[model samples]
Target chain A: MAKRDTPMLDELLKGPYPSFVKELYKVQERKPMVQDLLGQLEDSYEERIGHWKHGGIVGVMGYGGGVIGRYSDLQEKYPAVAHFHTMRINQPAAWFYTSDALRTLADIWEKHGSGLTNMHGSTGDIVLLGCKTDDLEPCFADLTAAGFDLGGSGSCMRTPSCCLGKARCEWACYDTMKLCYEFTQEFQDELHRPAFPYKFKFKFSGCPNDCVASIARADMSLIGTWKDEIQVDQAAVADYAKGGMDIVSDVVMNCPSKCIKYNGNGIEIDDHECVHCMHCINAMPKALAPGKERGATILLGSKAPIMEGALLSSVLVPFIDLNDEDEIEDLKELIGNIWDFWDEHGRNRERVGELIQRVGMATFLDGIGLDPEPEMVSAPRDNPYIFFQDEEEEEDDE
Target chain B: MGTPSIPEIAEEMFQMVSESMGKKNLKAGDLTKAIRQKYPEVDRKTCKLALRELMDNGRCVYAYFGGSYIQLPHKEGAAND
Candidate 1:
């Protein structure tokens, strides 16, 4: 009897991109494992025909949430592929890729992939979109041998990434790169395991400008900040003013707490009123700078669209002394506790933010022993009655 | 192009139907409506082909709920309409 042909290959080749199937054709040149991936890919294609053709989910059992690997069949007949599997690679400390490393990665990709890349995914990883399951292990091994590694997916802890801080930026309040590296090493187990309730992302910023958008996209947003007085040099202020610095309109107006004031000769900052949003420092870099006591402000519960639209993470640890190992460990313990608590209690598809919303924030605070503060509230505006002081007694006209 | 097989399209349609249903059953016309939401690139004809394939394979059957029409997969050993 003739082999049962499913016509799967015909339909898949009709897609806008057919390169994944094309890649399988080069089975001779591909690594032996790639052949396995090809076979699995075909099997996956067969299985996906009924579901993916229309639109449905296909995920592994052990993992919580992942893009169900979808494929357009067409491989049994036509061998040429126009697309391949893609992965989102998380960059190192500051993404300072060595020239040699860059060349090697490009070469590896050129050899194996379609070479199209989405420079950065919303969460800040280099997303490479076409590879096979068999290629996964070996590709990771190759990348690792050449000083690269697979980033987190599914329920694993994603790569802890950071922005360029002291290395070249003038506004760096803390050593973001070092801290990112340290966290990467410290949370290796979390980074590799697929046992969490859902995926967790960590992003660090050098200052409040949030180049990496940690506030809007990560579960843990570490933004560089300080509690000490702003370093205001009158001479520098004068120089910046001479160089056409709009101190009043630019810096003072933008200050979150109106902490800055321009008095003809110089800019004055009321330290007690500064919320350290970094607006003044960013606007007048030379005139105003951060204090010597550099640390990080840690926020939690942000994400890119799961339970709801994107959320802006809220401050968890107002200030953490990153210089001390014990302090770092404190943060680790907090993270571990939250992860453990969430892992045991979180629904399969829910994120930490979702869980927090489901269970009252008060309960989460109690579980973690975190003191509830006004800043900890998901929406400060949600409780108008609490913050309403009724205009401070209205002068008590008797 | 070769005529797509019933089972092939059924499997893909089942998933698409499930995603479109999203914890709710929708009418046959609603499948095209929902399909367009997810794959704006594909035309209503392609979606109908998918639906036809699904129905042929017994993955979905029509019924009435809340005084409106809706389509759902025939659950294994389910009572007949």
Candidate 2:
């Protein structure tokens, strides 16, 4: 009696694309290794046994913090069809994996673990899930041997993730990748040790567009910004208008600050009033451009799924000059100071965002020696839809 | 789409809702506001239904023993014991 396998298959076939079960089918036949594993997995399912289990303290020798593997004590009763967990490979200052790397990763997963992967886990590691506990040791050996390692988890500072800022995006105001890499290296000890009150995540984006959703995700968020001018191409704006673009209604009239104006001639921007919200730049991609004097604005206190819902990581440092190495060191020191404070006072599973919220943002600023500014609040709600005092003046006459 | 089995948190939550004497019992709207703050991921209506379950389970006592504005009763002798 070929045990009950089709029910599980049927259940898997019922919903959604990018299904791991469907992906498993791609290698089910061609790969002898996978076929063998699937056969064993089917047996466990027939007995209604669990395929995944847990294990003990395992890391590479000499490296206090390499791969951490887990195994199930009940492997005899519940045979695992696959290994599950994550790996934290060292990312380049701005990781740009070659096609070969992608292929190698896929091949390795097909051989030793589940073929499924999250492009990059929230922890900033190339997360490979579903590897067995026993396979963890060998997998770690192979990975580290091939030059990879585990990311921080369990009270340690997790891997710092960042956007490919200036490397690819024109909106990049600063070198985000460098800061992310430098922070990871600088805080390696903190990354490996689980001594803090809760987890901390740092994410950097090249621009305010926040490709990484850092504002809503990371404990510390770095977004690129400028205190300089907005470069407007008059020729481009004129061309857009010529191309049947309504500059008045679309660009000038819709300017959040009424910062841009068109009077039958060309366009003008009142630079002081521009909030650098990226709306105009996004609206007229060709006409407007970001300024050259690039710097990063640092924010803290963003987390999801706990306490007061999703809080937008608010800006702390409006601008930090990223032009020099010394500046980077200064930023690292500041980060270190914050971690030390949080580690000492944070409760278990409490993220830095939660701690900051509890301790009050004012205390956090005092600890870091940062002065509070009005911009520390959410960027001024710029939508002109609401009738303000000035608008009421106009309404009175009407 | 399949109708989700109302979350257990729904009934589990009414135990926490404080009922003022003169106020209307927990309406779907008020329950939604309270539970949404703590457990925003779950459906508000489901949470209300969970409150209903708690009422059925005898774990929670409601206003007038029937209306909304429910409260989880202290376990017998457990508080002092």
Candidate 3:
């Protein structure tokens, strides 16, 4: 194949920031498919439209997902990249990896793919950008032999991801890595097969800080929290005072709930009013810490913009003991109930959040066998109108 | 009637796909519901296993027209474009 001119793409290389095109140029020598990829992208830029087409059946044997089929409409023009499909490989819990493991993946990709990879896709899968249909089974075989597997795709339970919890962060109240790995193992069938009306995602954050952004992205979000009062060390507070830290302006005034009072000597926090926002603790990490009683809050139905609009997760269970075995089983049963409801009632391509919105929240709660709690809503209804079931009408029907 | 075997379910699914080739697009959930309606003893897990067998044997393939659908593979000489 001859080199195609890509003036528009070439302009991107002129900037000071490191360019991916430059990296592709380096890999083009080993895998010539990169050259065709660049040429097609250049054509897309020129025409102001993408040339790639989706919707082909391609996967490893016995699997319905993990491989996304793609074809170039300009296949005749760029034959090398005519069948460049993508694969999503499941990442280890918390994305921890050894150098040897990474080398093994690189060797396998070099043998069967275009050698281009996204370190992690949006849903936390290691995305292999381009491969032929013929290479999929062999590549998957190599991956599984090395203790790796493909992540979920299509209408199934997507790869569960979490923040670095007890592994590194002190603010972590639960073992997020352990929970993520356990869920991934327990739901392997759902991960490998299409089992839902549409895609579902799970994300865990070690603390209410929500470093993983689960509240905005996941269908199910588990965020760590504590039940008791905040811990304070007066000596550390004295040291901060000696260092000339402005306790009133920086910590007290900054508390969203105004539950903190800065005495001339030390600071006091009203535990009753504290919403666990973690602002004061963040402002004075050395002087303050989370309480001993720790657990997680479960929220549900978050998603990206689609049929209705974007939505953040809503509080479902105010608090749950993640460390207790029986409590975990209860949580799993709740998850099962939620999936059953959505599978029976959801339309094609409808996310769980959209389904919840289509049916009133009360109906969804009733279907899942959960009682309505004050924490579920952000605010009470302003209007006084209420509808009650007529007991006389029900008695007559019976 | 006795519980339907995996191969039996796969055959039924293949026929469903064949009959609905161009008229309607069927999803995996749709096929599972239809199969369960026929054989009440078959569970969701077994239904999925049957679908897998159908794909592995090239009896049916998944097509993505806006969303995923189960359908028969294209015949020879047909243009994918």
Candidate 4:
């Protein structure tokens, strides 16, 4: 086939500002619609203003989720991609894609919408960039046939996601992939419907290193950790020391808690003071390893902040065994309780963090039937200062 | 008119955004600032609601450049019929 002539983008080839556009075509597979899409990019430019405007409600049937509605400025000028509906396809755990699956997705997208994709969007879904209202059904059907379903797009739960835990990492304290898949499967209703005040996102990280940055991204975040002492290889430590390793400077001194010490030949770590950070293990892989007592810490209220400022998720449930059976059941129960409380009380567009700020932490804990823990509060109230505030005034605010 | 209704206030804000952001796309802050300056009586929440309304109707799109900029819907289509 001759090089797909991207007439729409031809002009950008020579212009001073065309370097980015020219660079896109550098890839061999960057042809056809990707080329065409990029070509039409300048059509939306300030100079080449599109004329169409958004007006009516456009969506697919039966499903109240997945589709994000938007439109073109001038339908006649860019008729090929005038109507651009973004679809969020629920991704596999860690976005694992078989060659066949990717081929299937690309085939479906090519037939129904622009083959352009956002790869994996920040929400951890395979974001199909552009679609028409007419093709949504066919596209959706084909994707579902390929064993792919649409992810949460409306005010319900966003797709549950996790880092590549046991699938490809040694520091994983639990099967993050399995848990993410389970959460996606189990919480279909939350993922498909706009039940809560706003969207909820669940993300998991294998360890406190937080490869996926779950602490800053997810509303409900889980980071794997251990509660016991880090297993030590005394012989390995001695070898490293013997090999002229700076055990005192690197391992002992760098221990955040000052719990590690070198006694000339080997290293010793105070188990009680260990915060379960993977720092020591990372520094000396052969000499140290994660402890045996593995579990996960659940954090809450992380978001980028539209209503309130950006907030990192705070530890809610400090340690929960992430093993199978009892762990899943307990997790489900806790999740349910949390959702129920939020559904009943959360205001429109009020994220969990904002809700907690609006209603006191005491109320949230009481509503969820959870006892107050030291990790629950955003900041410590250790000032030993007490102020009497009338309950009546506070009630009016919530 | 004695204080415009929410929808009316929203429409006014949208018009201002369209006028202010002629060819150049705009951040919510810039548009919000322009709207507030023009319609000082209109509150922030009302302004946001209007922008959201435009977004839902497909009239507005977020150009993901520097933080999210709301531009007149240029690409992407949906059935908001």
Candidate 5:
């Protein structure tokens, strides 16, 4: 955008409050519209008295979703961007977009919106920000005509996102794209309807690497992993050793559990002691690979702060065989149970993480009808890491 | 015609919106017009409330424009997941 005559913004540029808008404008790859909006807001600082009111129900056509309500307090002053709503177009699985498709999306948005877009947010929605109320239908029409639909907003299930798993990554233990797409289709009502106490997020990672950081962000997390021992290729190991790679110092010694032994021929792993950190595999990729047995580990209650502090999702199910026919069904049933329990007991605006915190893990476990395993205990109070069965040992000692 | 209850009018309005649009979006004004034929005694305020209830219950969406519009959200003609 040709620098508009923003007298008020110029004045604020000299202010002490860090001048974030100016700083943003200084960025090399900034979108001009965003800078323009910031400039507009700065120009009419006095006219904009307060924040715009939101959270009232708003949407369009046969669906109970798509449109997000937005407005500017300075509607009278800035008529062009008065009721600037946000439209969340559902991003493709792993955001695989061709250049032509991307250009089409940009063209459509420019036609309907103020040309302000957030490529993708943490929730994985292709967010088209700064849209007018009247342009909702036309914008949606153009978008849908071009084969795009909206994702969830409001108190409903937010968009389900996943990492690039089977598409490109060899470390992927399961098909993240299939599961992500299947679940998105399967849970349409959840995606659209604002029935729950608060928004729910589902993010999937192909493996423990958690490139998407779903463990700390998603309300529910699915991580791919192998159930069996790590596979060690003896030939590759010998090749690495011959190629000036120090197996004893690098792989064996650096093992978190020290379960790896460099037998001078091949490395031996104490299967039970392996932590699945992927460190050895990453360091010596040619020599080691994930085991054949593959599935996912379900982690629950991950969230960012609203009521409580941010938390990583705790392991709910250590190993779920995603390959099994009944496993997906079981997973769905588990999700349903969790939702039911949360719906019945969750306070308004409280996320699933906050709900679990308010009611304790035992209650959550019972609510889902899952028998609490020792694996579920993220932290232990006393010693005896190995022989942890029940409270009987503590009682006996007492 | 006698006045219809909020829930009755809301349900009917919801149905009208669904049938009227099929997959397309329905303006809130359209529902008001249709609802008036059946329940002439209902005013815009009450109709709006009923509409709000429907929207909240996931029957419809607000359409998120400067003004209120109700539409039955559908999953058609969109990109594949």
Candidate 6:
């Protein structure tokens, strides 16, 4: 195939930051489809409109998701990218990968796809950019043979991802990677099938630091936290003081809850008021650590701007012992209850957060068999109006 | 009656969707609920599997009009050509 002119896209190659367009150009000789991709993208840029059309059904047999069908309106002009379907392969726990695994994936993609990829998509899947419908089955077969499977797409549970918690970070309160892997394994059917009212995502962050941005992204966000006091090393604190680290401005004053104070020689944290925000811990990593009674705080209904608007997840269960098997099972049961309620009540394309907004939080909690909790709200309502059901009226009706 | 097989459920789903085309926008959850109501023994997972079979066999397709709906192929907004 001859290289199509892409002057507009070529302009991207001259920037200070390394350009993906430049990378595509580098691989154009071996994989000619990338050149066509660039050409089509440049055409779209020139036209100020997207050339891709959605709503094509494409996937492996018995699976309802994982392959997103794409077709270009400019099919005749750019035949190479006419059917540029994308595949989302589930990434390994915490995105850990061997070079061999990566090479194998690349080899398969090169054989069956446009040799373009997003190392990881926004939902933490290995996004194989472009392929024809004919190649999808064989590509999936090859991937599954190599012990890799497709991630979720459509209105299903998206591939659950986590931060490298106990594996790398000191502040990690729980085994985030383990929980992520467990959820992925447990909900394999959900990942491969489109059954929900809208897409559901699970994200595990080791601590309130939320390295994975679970609070703003996931439908179910599990952030690590502790019920006990913050652990402190006074010797390390004195060392930080000796090194001229400003404990007052950096740690004490910066605490969102104002629970920490610099005591001239060391620092003291007010455990009850700490709020488990991880600010002080982050500031003095060597001197401070998370308490021993570690678990996770479950939050719910976060999403991008779709129906109601962008929303961060609200607190659901303020703290849960994820390490306990029974508690984990309880958590899974809670997830099922949540899905059942949403599937029955939610409209098409409406996210869980929007559904919660539509049906008052109280109703939602009741529907899911959970009692209202103080932690679920940031503050008590200031409004004088309170809708209440009288017990006498309820007894009479019954 | 015994629990409906996957193929049986798929056929039933195709009929329901084909009948509802242009009249009702039936989503996956709707089909699952309908199937469960009809069979009573068939679980949600089996219903999902049946829907997958229908789509895979080209008997039914997804139509995205604001949200995803199941419909016959070649229908308006159907995801199959």
Going through the candidates in order, what fraction of the true interface contacts does each contain? 0.00, 0.00, 0.33, 0.05, 0.08, 0.30
In model 6, pairs of residues that clash are none
Model 3 spans with C-alpha error above 4 angstroms = A378-398, B1-6, B39-42, B52-58, B73-81
Top candidate by TM-score:
3
For model 6 chain A, the run of ten residues with the poorest summed lDDT: A378-387
lDDT comparison, 3 vs 5, better candidate? 3
- How many steric overlaps are in each model, in order? 25, 16, 0, 15, 14, 0
Model 6, A89-166: lDDT tens per residue?
A: 999989999999999999999999988899899999999999987899999999999999999888888999999999
Estimate, for each residue in A129-208, the C-alpha lDDT of model 5 and write its tens digit. 87765678888889889888899876677889999999999889988888899999998866764456667899989988
Query: What TM-score does candidate 2 get on C-alpha atoms?
Result: 0.69
In candidate 5 the C-alpha lDDT for residue B12 amounts to 90
Full candidate order by TM-score, most accurate first: 3, 6, 5, 4, 2, 1
What is the TM-score (0 to 1) of chain A in model 1?
A: 0.76
Q: Please write out the lDDT profile of model 1 over residues A1-398, one tens digit for every residue.
A: 10223255446656788554554445424444344345445555777632111112222122212222334343333233211345656577788878887788776665555444566666556666555434544555566678776565555678778888889887777888998888888876555434455678888898777888888888889988887898987898889889887778888788767777788987778998777777777776776788988888888888887557777777777788887789988988898778756754676556777787788666776677666555454531233112312334454442
Q: What is the lDDT of residue B52 in candidate 4?
A: 61
Q: What tens-digit string does per-residue lDDT give for candidate 4 at A1-398?
A: 11445555656676766454555566325334444445456555635775434333334443335777656654454455566778889999998888989998988987887666888898889998777778888888888888999987655788999999999988899999999998888988567544456678999899888898888889999999888888999998888888888888887777777888888867788888776667789888898888889989898888996767997876778789989679779888988888767856776567887787788767887788777665554622222111223455687788
In Å, residue A168's CA in model 2 sits off its true spot by 1.6
Over 4 Å off, model 5? A1-3, A6-36, A41-54, A62-64, A379-398, B1-81
lDDT of each: 0.61, 0.62, 0.84, 0.72, 0.74, 0.83
- Candidate 2 on A1-398: residue-level lDDT in tens? 11224456546657865555565666555544344445555655777785443322333332223343433333443344333344555555556888887777677766667665667665567777566545666776666666556676544566788888878888998888877877877776556533345567888888888888888888888888888788888888888888998888877777777888897667888889987778888888898888878888888888888635777676677688886788777887787678656745565466777777788777776676666665675433423221234456689989
Off-target runs (Cα >4 Å) in candidate 6 are A378-398, B1-8, B21-25, B36-46, B49-68, B71-81
DockQ of 5: 0.07
- Per-residue lDDT tens digits for candidate 3, residues A241-287, read 88999989989998988999988788899998888889888988999
- lDDT comparing candidate 4 with the true structure: 0.72
lDDT of 5 by residue, B3-72 (tens): 7888988999878777766465445545666776567777755775676678767766554332234556
List the candidate numbers ranked by DockQ, top first: 3, 6, 5, 4, 1, 2
By lDDT, who's the top model here? 3
- The local lDDT score (0 to 100) that residue A95 gets in candidate 3 is 93
